[model samples]
Target chain A: MRFAATVEVQLRPGIADPEGATIDKAIAALGIAGVSEVRAGRCFRFTVEAEDLASAEEVADSLGERLLSNPVIERHLTTIEALG
Target chain B: MSMRVAVVTFPGTNCEHDAIQGLEAVGAEAVFWWHTETSLDGIDAVVLPGGFAHGDYLRPGAIARFSPVMAAVADFAAQGGPVVGICNGFQVLTEAGLLPGALQKNAQLTFACQPCGLEVAQTSSVLTRGLEIGQHLEIPINHFSGSYVCDEATLASLEANDQVVLRYRQNPNGSVANIAGICNVAGNVVGLMPHPERAISPLLGSSDGLHLLGSLVSSLPAHR
Candidate 1:
């Protein structure tokens, strides 16, 4: 089976997000109101070849855990969909 | 005989030459070992110099940690051989699981390149054996992501083990507990964000780095 996966990596909560804060400040400077808590993260998309959807999800999670993110400071969420 | 230190260079590494020159100035024979090499034959110590390895893709040092040379470097360190990582090298060490903790983006979201003040926190590690506790040194730090972070439990263990080798006098990048450098529990592996190689001469504004590099050279075992 062929599945497409996207992994979203973000700094763990309580870890300082300087880039995110900078963006939030810029948003406020644009004269926008009520916009707060802007957080920045990275998303990686790729296709995986697996026997089943479960296998594909596993592959995506493994990639996110091992290579796509640093567990010490970042956390990742993986989403997979079967390709028709 | 002088200590033979292997300076590992990954793609995008730009500080190998400076590290070599600094090591030689301190009387250690420095040699370049490319990232592809799997064997660290006859190398007494290893130094991972600072640079944007793999262009800092997918986080600094994340890609570079998978290089073939790291396995050999890990083996060398397991045997009690000294290993020192500077700046990006420190990032690599953490990514490679050879060292604890991670370096995040600077608290101010700005790249810092300035002379930094550091206090010697411990003297048992390879990088600070010759220095005295509470002694201060002027070293330059150049990086955008240099903030050190680790869990509270790990921090407590590190403190208990005396693994914190250096602490920033002014907390340049918002590192926890003002940590500027730390060693593994065994004291054979060390990682620091400061650029000691850039401070090797009086003309460079300070030669305090010599005290650190000299300590590494003198701490090497005579046999290997």
Candidate 2:
């Protein structure tokens, strides 16, 4: 069985986060950053034990699209780890 | 030579008539504009009244901001036309990025509907013209996502620019800084959580709202 959840990152509307910009500036100063700007967002981790990885991924993907994240303002990433 | 105003109605909007009535009460010749219609030609000002547009789905105002009528609203606003958004209309303005900060779910986790007192925070806005600064008025609020949230810097800039138009006398919805109403930097557009249309008559138990509506008539065009 596998359990997995998705995480998302997006800036809260109307809030100016200088911290995210400063971090990007530091990364660019090192000449190692490809992104010009960064906005910190949020992640949601939930458990969905399934019979297999494929099933878990399917559940996670749908959940990500339908419930966990707003597609209009959110970007999502998912990973699966076995639960003890 | 009548001052012509237009009230926009989205799919689920229930308060267009109320808005029209309120505007008409103040002597403006008010009419309705459909969300499908993109242009508000011949109108001196525009009002986006409250009610659940699209049943408050996909986040309040998120979907309605891009409606065809909003194009005209945006253009009119850029031209410095007075645009007022009451309740859900306020949500639409914030979602459209015409105003700063977003209204979040009330911290108490309840949908509040009652009379709330507000202090005039900015009188320079066309929506607040002829009003004295720091004056108090009672308006009715009805919503779940009436809580206002903004980052410290943006909040500070708004304060510095005098964009806050109204503040609640008593914090009712856990809003940041007790903000109940705010205007854009230009002060032509204002978004407020309370419903002025719900408060504009002596029969309604408080006529303090008339002062704000009367403010709209300040230098407005004659009736259509």
Candidate number achieving the greatest DockQ relative to the actual structure: 1
Model 2 iRMS = 9.9
Candidate 2 regions off by >4 Å? A1-84, B221-224
Q: How many backbone clashes does candidate 2 have?
A: 6
- C-alpha TM-scores of all predictions: 0.99, 0.75
Question: Chain B of model 2: TM-score?
Answer: 0.96
Chain A, model 1: TM: 0.98
Per-residue lDDT for B1-224 in model 1, tens only?
88999999999999999999999999999999999999898898999999999999999999999999999989888889999999999999999999999999999888989999999999999999999999999999999989999999999999999999999999888899999999999898999999999999999998999999999999966235
Colliding residue pairs in candidate 2? B1-B222, B2-B222, B2-B223, B2-B224, B3-B222, B3-B223
The DockQ scores of all candidates, in the order shown, are 0.95, 0.04
Tens digits of per-residue lDDT for model 2, B23-72: 88888888988899967888888888999887877678878886888988
Interface RMSD of 1: 0.4
Error of 1 at A52 (Å): 0.8
